[model samples]
Target: MELKDRLLTIAKEIPPGSYPVDVGTDHGYLPAYLVKQGIVSRALASDIGEGPLLAAKQHIEALSLSDRIELCLCDGLTGIDLSDKTHIVIAGMGGETISEILLRRHPLTQTLLLQPMTKVETLRRFLLKHGYRIEKEIPAYEEKKAYTVMLARYDGIVREGDDFFWTFGALPQSKKKEKYLYFQSLLSRLEKKQKGLQKAQTQERTELDRLAILIAKAKEYLQEELYDHHSGNL
Candidate 1:
């Protein structure tokens, strides 16, 4: 099975011996790919709706992976078992929804790979405040759309981050060129929002101030990157 860049990034994070449970598995592509690649012996693919679950079932059956991949119809790990060394994967969902799923039923799985389609800062804030430490974040872009796959683990250490941390979670420190692109994307979004607010002639002071700060930070980061490259320090 072929996986998209976003799903492939998430798949790369799964270790060889893992028993993964893909939450909200749209078409069961990730699980089937992992099992077919010999990365994992078996995987459980679950979706909240019957339509998506049936679609996944047909895909698995066509791939001759029905025995290796199990399909379940459940709402965000509500009835899933995590007693074994299960790795949780929640992708293609909103950040608020992912946060709600984790908040409702905190998994015992050692690792969680989460990919939020929107409101990524909200998800990062919730994860840190609720004792889940973001071990790593891998950025992926497909069709000019930016996405990140966050590898997190429950460490029981609650930490509150500032606006910058919430906006760019350990991305600035990354050596990958995608880090700069991600920052640029955020800056573009914020600039557009500021323009919209200004055009309406009704601006929220707090929001405008936050945007100004983030914009300045992003510019400074890009400036530093350019300087380092020119100085042959990168």
Candidate 2:
């Protein structure tokens, strides 16, 4: 089966030297691709549901890669003694759900390759709060949807006030033209809901304001910081 453009980008972001644990691996294509590309030594394909695990098993079996890829039926790595050499991948899931999985693991993980389908800001905030650094962010446009593939390491806790930037990358560098337009589109959608938001409780308005801050700060970064060009490395 052909990998979708977004998932292919995610597969590409895995470091070249380490085996990865594909959490919630629906079809096992990522592990299949990684091993085939020599990007990883082996793979542990896992999913919480039995249905997906069965499919994963079929994939490995068909590839005749049973020796190289191990399939596990796990609910977010629960009760699994994951090896220290394993990098966990949790993509194609919601940010909030991904956060819970990492929280369940606590402070032990080799690396995290995460791509949240929705609530991306929530996912980034969770990673930063739990002490993960954005190692690399690869951007891709697939099926006319732009997505970000993030490589994260358990570095240290970072409480950034920049509003969920860890999902995209640090604000300073993420202000690339394409991302800027995406942010603007998000803000435009929110503004169109101004009437509904304005009628909401004070707390909801506050939440909307916080979300808007991302676009506001981004504009500042593009108009001002990009031109500075000297205070820090580009």
> What tens-digit string does per-residue lDDT give for candidate 2 at 143-208?
656666677788776756454454245432553544554445555655556546666644676667
Residue 26 shift from truth in candidate 1, angstroms:
1.0
- What TM-score does prediction 2 earn? 0.78
Q: Top TM-score: which candidate number?
A: 1
The predictions' CA RMSDs to the true structure, in order, are 2.1, 4.6
**Residue 33 lDDT (model 1):** 96
- Residue 175 of model 2, lDDT score: 33
After superposition, the stretches of candidate 1 with alpha carbons farther than 4 Å from their true spots are: 172-175, 226-228, 231-234
Weakest lDDT window of 10 consecutive positions for candidate 2: 166-175
lDDT of each: 0.85, 0.73
